[model samples]
Target chain A: MGIHLPSLLPQMQELGQALYERSLQVSAMIPKAIKALHSTAELDHSNLQSKIKKAGNRWTGAIPTEETLNLTYPPPTVPQSLHVIGADGSQIYPDRHAAAFYYLINIGSIVVSHGSGKAPTIQQESQLFFELEDLYDEADHPVQNAYVNLRRDVAEMKTLTKIAESLAGEQTLAILDNSLLLWMALQTGGSTSRETDRTLQQYLKLLDRLRSSKTGLAGFIDRPRSVSVLALIHLAGLPDDQINQETLRLTPFRGLTDRAIFTKLLAPGHRSALFISASPLNRDFRTAGHEVHFFYLNTDADGAVVRVEIPIWVAQDPELLNRVHAGILKDCQTTGGFPYTLVRAHELAVIPPQERAALEDMLQRTLLGHGLRPTQSQKALTKQLTGQRKQHTL
Target chain B: MPESPMMIGRVTRCSTRGFVGAMQISENALPVFGSLCQAEAQGGRSYVVGLVYDISITDDQFARQLAALEEVPQEQIADGQINRHVPVEFSALAVGFHNDGGFHQALPPQPPLTLASVFSMVSKDSVDFTSQLHFLQTILNAPQLPVDELLTTALRLSAQARPEEERERFLLQAGREVAHLLPQDLTRLENILRGLRA
Candidate 1:
């Protein structure tokens, strides 16, 4: 009714063709890139290593790996009586259209008792941030998106830590549906946000507690684009000058990502060699005794390979690593690509738009009950009017 | 003076003809298929008494995911079932009301408010509610409800809730009352009595 579908059919065909052709081009480059990464990983590029060491916080993006190209395709082996814990977070960002700028975070957790024929136990915790201090930083600046996200990350880890503390017996694996490396915090050159650092401290402490509970923690990133291995690709060029952000940006491997390479590299159940994340955020993690390492796992051949990141404890233990691999593959079989626990956790945690609207209505009513008129933004009022008119025309 | 009936749920959707509520019922202490339940209304000045008719058990997502765990030991699902807050929903048709010192066989002046706590009617309340034949008229006059179903259920519950000696008398009076109310519909009267007899 609105866009006239018949008129756009030809253009849609062209768009699809362009996307298909581009994917083919990306696929063509993977073999050479993989070969370059393998050779560079074998070479002793002391100059690039020195450059990375001095690159400091100013350097953005992933650093390359120096591991053998050969990867292991292990047979899936999950423990019979393992407890798989999955947690995910969903948040309503601070909205300007609403009467008082506020945010809401809901974290959901599911603990599946594998080998125990029962429904998995699930829990959800919700918190509203409308307090004065919560809405703004100490300097009275409104909290930015980055800060809010960091808080959510902290909240998620805190939930996992609590679940670990309360749950006992049976080996536990805590799976996070996100990257463990705090890449956002690392981008703030030299000095990181104070709130981020303190939160990271708490997060690491929780990780320690989870590890102590004998729960191996892993972060699952489906269709990962991180080529910390690309740093090695860049290092192979034999740059004469110390590598800075400028030199790293101009490196040969610009248009490529790791998913294209690993999609061809691994088969179902095969995992790539573990490589430490060159994300600067991992430096603090390394200092605190929990170095983050990642491997590309082809959970299903139909989809892209997933990058599974783990702390030192999980990467070092062959038994834990195998369990993680098998656990992910087994879970993926149910959901087609992602783990079932994560899917359930996300479902439980997500707050739909209807819910957010209802909450805002309630908030507005409560504010009005106290004799305060909650004013709507002019832009929001106009949008509402336009939307109603648009609906009528349709 | 009587044991308090467990508060099962709060009124979610409400009206004079009937009301639905969301209940937190467990696997063990679930209510019967048809039981007498009451809800407080108008600051306890009166109460709405109704017959529990429809019960819908949610937690589909919970069950579907659990069913997927074929690898999980059967015993865990059997005995290891932790306390679950399963949402049990039931809609009840308002049969009568109790005010001051009297029970009427008609709708209350006001519908029970939303979020009102619905309680399992204690045996004493049930015995008292079915003491008279007037409640039968309330069900027949209320055409929107499952009249035959409610009449049979109320009769059976009253018989059980009453003293052992008066149980036969209660059902006999209900049979006579149904025969009188639906004299034109003999088939319907027979069905109701046959249901009660069973």
Candidate 2:
């Protein structure tokens, strides 16, 4: 029998009811917490500042002044080329006796480049096939197949990376479908399934290769497994002051902004972390023997956004972080703003359907002025976009 | 009406020889038995005749054997003799045809007969009869010869039979026999059989 969405309607209804009730409870409690905070403001500030200053004193003895190395070159007029690759796999069992097969779709597109304020070249293409029979025995269960499929996905990623490397230029940005690296040093020599261990080792190896390559790798992983692994890695390398100050703070009331609270409490250069999505971490996260520093970026109606601290030791140098930040900022300006952020200019560059092609043409013209010749594929894409634009107008 | 015992013997031998001759025409033909049931006794004796022929030789040899069986002795038998037993068997010593006079006297006439000749005729006729019998046997054993093959084979065999009454009787019997079989299985078999026929 097919999976009917209607069958899940009752559960969804129940969840909706629960969420409604929970929201009401949070609403009632927030005002009480706000009132309490206002009454305790004076007493809390004096005590908290003293406690924070005492904690900060241990690390305040010496400030190291490292000369800022400038890698920023003269502004090159090359057209900004942004490439985003997102892959998704769906497993389907067509019949009872037939094996469950996975269909993996890797979608890659050239987004806007650094110098050109142009609309990104977006391409959506896919590949489909049956899962290889040799990868698993018929007797193997679904969970085992999940691990196998993950490894298959990783292998696909490696191939994609190679392609990205070949296509990548000095100004190119490669966005992975998932996390670029997984720390699994603690998983080494542990009593885990051989398949699981092998998958972790493969992930680690891929990360190593990506780091060594000239192409920059960024992944958009929505799953909790990837997030927690990132969080753990971030926490391990946290500067001491952040940890000491954060340890004493009360867990904020549920509806309050946890990230805001952490930010207020944190000393300059200190870190605070928040977990979003509430998904269980992937199995590899349990044993990824690495010290990670986690910093909570913000908490708002959109939920918490956090950053995983990549240790200078593993990241090889602190300059890489500076480069990453510079790259992100440059991408923001070139693409009209950061693609991942809610920055106003970035949103404007994402032209609505009706104006997409016209906007693309305008951007292309601008890019041409910067001496970037569009490839043949890009020309075909532009033609298609223009056609779509005409159709939308009609 | 009962024929003379000599005539009955002659007829039985002729029928048996005919059966064996037909079998000898095909090397792969299997030896088979034929049974004819009658309501009343013939010549005051109930008889069941069985015949077989071994045709290990080539077609030429088989034809020579059939020629010998046609020359069986009839003169020695008494007229209108009833309930008499006449058992005749022979092997080829020499074989020659009677020659007409062309300035020379005709060769002495002799009864030409061989046991192989009688056996060959009986076996050949028996195979032809038994071919139909085997079809019936398969229907009885398998009870699932495709309805189409069964009906088509029945129709073909009926068309070939000399007696119309007998053909009608067999056809009626086959219809009643197949009614007990599974319809779908029979239908599928029928389709397969139709393909085979085409």
Candidate 3:
């Protein structure tokens, strides 16, 4: 019988021999590598824990001392009137396909004095602007309204700056919603595609003027990237001695405990402002050096004003910071245990009025036992609507 | 009934035992069964039906058989029709079978009865031997498969045999077949094998 076979036998034999050799070599090597890896892992675990403990201790004692402070000059004279501005923006999405509208509210309040003592009647000014653009639109065309709004903000900022300059004696702090605008202006160096860049440049020039005049400029930006930019700018300007002690620093704290304790611990005459929302436990607030008050500003059932104290903290205080940390850890042990009040307040503050009402309703229902009443404005509005209905029927 | 006499070989010297052992060694080092017939008169025409028995033999057995047969002088032996029982062991090499009723054959027997025919026979038994060999060659020649993939496959196959002895033997055989095809790192191969075990 004729038997046929493929002619590739030699090659196959060669391959088989090679594979056999390699397998043996590999079989011999594995045990050793695994052993080494295990040993290294064990060592690393112990070392890591010790290092962490050491670092925590160092951070605890790291607060700057008064002796380390290098003041180029004494603190400037306190202005007669201190203007604090706060701006918030809310985006509204009606449907999946519809463009969203951004409603911006800029609230500027003139605080007469720097200390806890009341001095003069506060003059409050608020401006509302709307930008209608689809969020899902092409990146290039995404809401040209921001640029228009930016131009308006620049004009307002100039006016505010001029007002600050013209005032006989006042410390003006013009708070912008974001630091990106200022950072971009500083980096643009005159080359930009949009005409708004010119106004932004002017704003930057105004900021420089404020710096020269010793008018403190601070911005509360939500994004970490903006913070990084600010840190970089501060690093470039300040000397090494001032880096952590006076100029640039970062404090990370969670929950209301640290905030409250820190604020209480602040020297009685020292003034500190806190940024807080509804959920105090879940979110992280990053501040440096100075103390901040963490509180909730919500409307009552009638939409009247209501303020709830959550937490307050000065970042430099070790005792208060430790307490805040411990409180957060303790909170983690509970179920559905979030600092909900702060979170809700933040949500209400960020959301537009139409949506805020629904959120407020949900919050009130959930927190009914907490004794939070609706604001007087909400009650009055409801009454007015009902009264108008009765009058129309008659 | 008439009685019919047919020459029957009892395999007085079987190469199976020794040859199989040698083959096992070779395979481990590198990568790489008997029958009788009975005749009886059934019809008036004295028709003879012979039962053929084929013993499955490995490469080593085939080698032993050849070694045993070498003692007989071919010239002195009667020139009768010699019917050898064909072994059915598949060869690791061979191409596709043709429709002409003839399957792929083994390579020529090497000197001292390397039994190239036996190898060919074994190779032809595998239906996909040809295709598989072609794939292996392509892999080796062109490096078609990723090195990681090849290592993983090798390790998995190596891990399949449970006892250390069996695993070693299996890997040895497989390694011989694909030694040149493997990458240089032994650790990588071990890792793949461990992964398979896991």
Query: Which candidate achieves the best lDDT against the true structure?
Result: 1
lDDT of 1 at B117: 84
Candidate 2 Cα RMSD after full superposition onto the native fold (Å): 35.3
How would you encode candidate 2's per-residue C-alpha lDDT over B1-198 as one tens digit per residue?
Answer: 522111111222222112122212221233222221111112222222222212223333323432354331121111001111112221111111112221111111322222222222222232233334323333333222243444444334433343555555554444444444434467654553453334
Model 2, A125-223: lDDT tens digits are 344344554334344533333443554456545654565565545444444333333432223223335656566667655545545554444443221
Model 3, native contacts kept: 0.00
**Model 1 agreement with the true structure over B1-198: per-residue lDDT tens digits:** 767888877899988877888866666666665687888888879888877778887665646666675553453354224435457888888888889977876888888899998888889878777777776786677666677887798789879888889888888888988898888998898999998889
Q: What is the TM-score of each candidate against the true structure?
A: 0.78, 0.33, 0.23
Output candidate 3 Cα RMSD: 36.2
TM-score of each model's chain B: 0.84, 0.24, 0.22
Better of 1 and 2 by TM-score: 1
* Shift in Å, residue B134, candidate 3: 99
- Worst lDDT run of 10 residues, candidate 3 chain A, spans A67-76
- In the range A66-133, model 3's lDDT, one tens digit per residue, is 21111111112333334333232333322222121333333233322223233222232334333333
Q: What DockQ does each listed candidate score? A: 0.19, 0.00, 0.00
Name the best candidate (by DockQ): 1
RMSD vs true structure, all candidates = 5.1, 35.3, 36.2
Worst 10 residues of 2 chain B by lDDT: B75-84
Worst 10-residue lDDT window for candidate 1 chain A reads A183-192
DockQ of the two-chain complex in candidate 3: 0.00
